[model samples]
Target: MHKKAIYIMMLVAVLLASCSSPGRKALELSDNMLKTAPERALAILDSIENAGGLNREEQLHLVWNRAMAHQIMGMSLAEDEQLPEAIIHYREEADKQTDSYLLEASYLNWKGKRADAINVLNKGIGKIKDSTKRVKLMAEQARLLELQREYSKAAEVMERALELNPTKRDKAILNYKIGLNLSLAGDPRSEQFYSQSVRMATENGDTAMACEFLRNYADYLANNGKYRQSNNVYREISRMMPQMAGLSAIQMAMAGNYINLHMPDSARICNEKAIESEARLEAKGFDDISRRMVIELERCLLDYGDGKPVSYVGLSRYCDSITADMHAKESTLARRQEAKERLQWANHELRLDRQRMGWMLAAAVLLLLLGVAGGWIYYRNRLSRLAEAENSIDTLKRMLKETQTPAEETPEEKQQKSEDDAFFKKILLQQLGIIRMVASTPTNHNQALLKRIAGISEGKIQTDSLLVWPDLYLVIDRLYDNFHNRLTERYGNVLTEKEIQIACLLCAGFSTKEIGVVTQQSDATIYVRKTSIRKKTGAAEGQDIVSYINGIKAD
Candidate 1:
């Protein structure tokens, strides 16, 4: 028994020492020929695979080494511009390796395989340990997030990457990306990152990127209504990149800024300079199509300024239609390029193949139909109630308009305005008092009768705006001077009573909310009414209903 134990111990010791030896030898041979003849080294690796001398840990190391070899093979192929072959090798490397997702995602990005890159990054990013590798993966992930339009999430990821990039130039690049994502996310701190990025790029002697950053900085200032400061930055851009192409576009923007600042005279002069610059560009061999478009746009604005409404509207629609077509063509071209490149990508290519086009199309159509049906039902019911109230008010307003005439205001006109405003506030206060009296009135019949006698309507009081608001609508329409006529003209009778009420209140600088306080409607119900009002009034994208309402002129 003692002799047998000694023999087993000696056998185990030799096996343990030899566990990783054979794989190491194979790896060393592959590494030596990596710069010279890699295929021969790969063949040596194949030969040693079945020699069966490696333990589990050694097998892992072997995979790591093999992944490195495949990466080198891909790099050489890429150097020769053999992109498809290179991508295939990169996919092979990525499949065998577990450490780096950045390398895998880069090749996928090269092939425009964004979904495949997302999958690879999602799988590998969490397991990464090396700071550099983790940083690269985070940055790539942020780019993918941006493509998905998850701008805030992308900014967060870029912030993490920013922490890992210690070098000034690298951090500067990351900071620029952070600013881009934050700006798109509509965060207020986007300017801070933009400033940091510009400072760092200046320190790194990258004048080109710094100038680009300054251009955007100027745009931020201009968008926030700071025209003089924005012009200062624009002047800085000219000093930096004197020969920069497309500076004429900035002149067009400056013209817009002047228009917003209520300086149409200055706007006209700036627009002339823009048109001249664009004409110069056309003379210097630039395409006439772009310059012609700019000229047409300027002409449309000028027509509006010159009070040629009919011509301006027609030309504006023409310009919009042509611009839409151009964008559609550009989108189609982008899709074609993406599809072509996707065909060359081979990483986990079958993962997204489960759903067919027919299935996806059917599912999408079903969802769209259901959504349209639900939306139509909701809006139909909501609008019907609103239209009823407005119809009653509209009849009264037509009578008022027929009686009134356009004339210079007298002191009686001013007195009527004050008296009407007082009456409107008194009615609103009385409405609130009625609601509170009804709520706080005792359940006893005599007490409720007393409340009802006091003009509270008691237990029979209507709380729904659709049920009780028609009277209130007529009163508000009559009391608010010129609200009904002005709103009808602006939106062409599309404004419902609820929307008109909101608009009148907003014009009066009132924080309009639920009509329950004034006409017994629930806050949520009124909010839905406001949403429908916005859609019907054609509020511009990103504009809130209240802002649109407040912009309506009462006179």
Candidate 2:
């Protein structure tokens, strides 16, 4: 039985090995497409992540390859005229990625954000321990500082990069950059560094790098009117790469130097040699488009220098191709801008949609609250009106019962009236106490109690006048029961809160001036309220509101 179980476990292990991990299939599919179709690979990777089948190792592979995909996307998408999105993707990829930082800094430098680009390089360098990468970052930072006109600081950075002991090829580039920086910093010794960089580039068989150093230094010399020295450097490059198509560039610069020095015959000879060298390089299978463009342009410049009519012949191919080159750069910039506008427009539309939804939601909430408030107000008013009507009917019945008696007053009626009056006053006191508590809050700034009381008095006249009038109505109903409904039913719905206050005070037999004092209203205000009540009751202008209110009967 034990041997059989061992055989069964071995079979299970073999089966497990035969099957793949959950995420492995998709990852393998993506890996196959990574080099040939990066965009499709990215989509596959994204789907795998969203569909959720990744193990721990698969997750790490996903992050590594996804970052690589984004880096490639930055290049291909930019070339495809999707630049803003491309740069954004590049920046996001660069954030945690050490290798991509240089690309991001280059973009920043092109944007004229030199300080920000340098800061990015500094942070990247701090994170990277690789000497080649550190040297590259430092050299770039030095170039940025030089562009900013901080020449000494630029030299300092370059000096630091040189201390990293880069390989021959990297040192050659860094040395050239440092020479440029030092030359611009007003150092005459920069020529030695330039010479060293050129010698090293030549020894390392990086003839192109050597040519770059020679060309830049020669151009600088020419610009400074050092024609003789610039001509020597050009001749040196011509000797180094005699059979290359690139010879046209050196001969052209040499011809320009000869022309500036008033050696027109020498310039003419160099121009002829440039035209001849072009045919040889073509025979040698040199297919550099930019170099050919420059060579043809120099051919044209040569004719102009020789005091001949500028030849339009043979310029069409290189001229139009160069024009396309110029347009390619311009279109790249325009596409970047177009991409930015598109993103901004999309974001703006999204924001507007969100704002519109928020306003709609707020309006919906407000309407719902208003509906609820309307129902509640109706319920409370209905209950109060009914209760006041029922109390008035009971009081009338009691009054009728007492009237039937000869002369004795009913104790129960007095007790009921007292209870009603007490209830009404209690509501008034409770409302006043709430007002006191609110007015006493820290929001009121804790002023003198007397001053606060005075402010409260003013508030009672302005706004709080309405709060008391409702309880006052209840008290009047308690005193005379159903008087409000009877008056309303007799008259129209013209009675307002102020009108009710006026009628109630008049029924209590208060003088107009005394009613004004009690209500915290001016005498003129009381008179106005009295007039309104009279109009509502349809009493004549000369009739007393108090007598009219007294004559109101429950029946």
lDDT of each: 0.62, 0.65
- Where in model 1 is the C-alpha error above 4 Å? 1-116, 126-133, 280-295, 307-555
Error of 2 at 66 (Å): 5.5
On residues 93-143, what C-alpha lDDT tens digit does candidate 2 reach at each position?
434355456656655666667788899899888878778778877877887
Model 2 accuracy (lDDT, Cα): 0.65
Estimate the TM-score for candidate 2. 0.42
The runs of at least 3 residues in candidate 2 whose Cα sits more than 4 Å from the true structure, single-residue gaps closed, are: 1-97, 100-114, 127-132, 143-155, 184-187, 202-208, 276-555
Residue pairs with backbone atoms closer than 3 Å in model 2 (clashes): none
CA shift of 490, model 2, Å: 82
45-156, model 1: which lDDT tens digit per residue? 6655333446654454445445445555654212223333333344435343333465456556556777887788876666665566667677778888898899999889
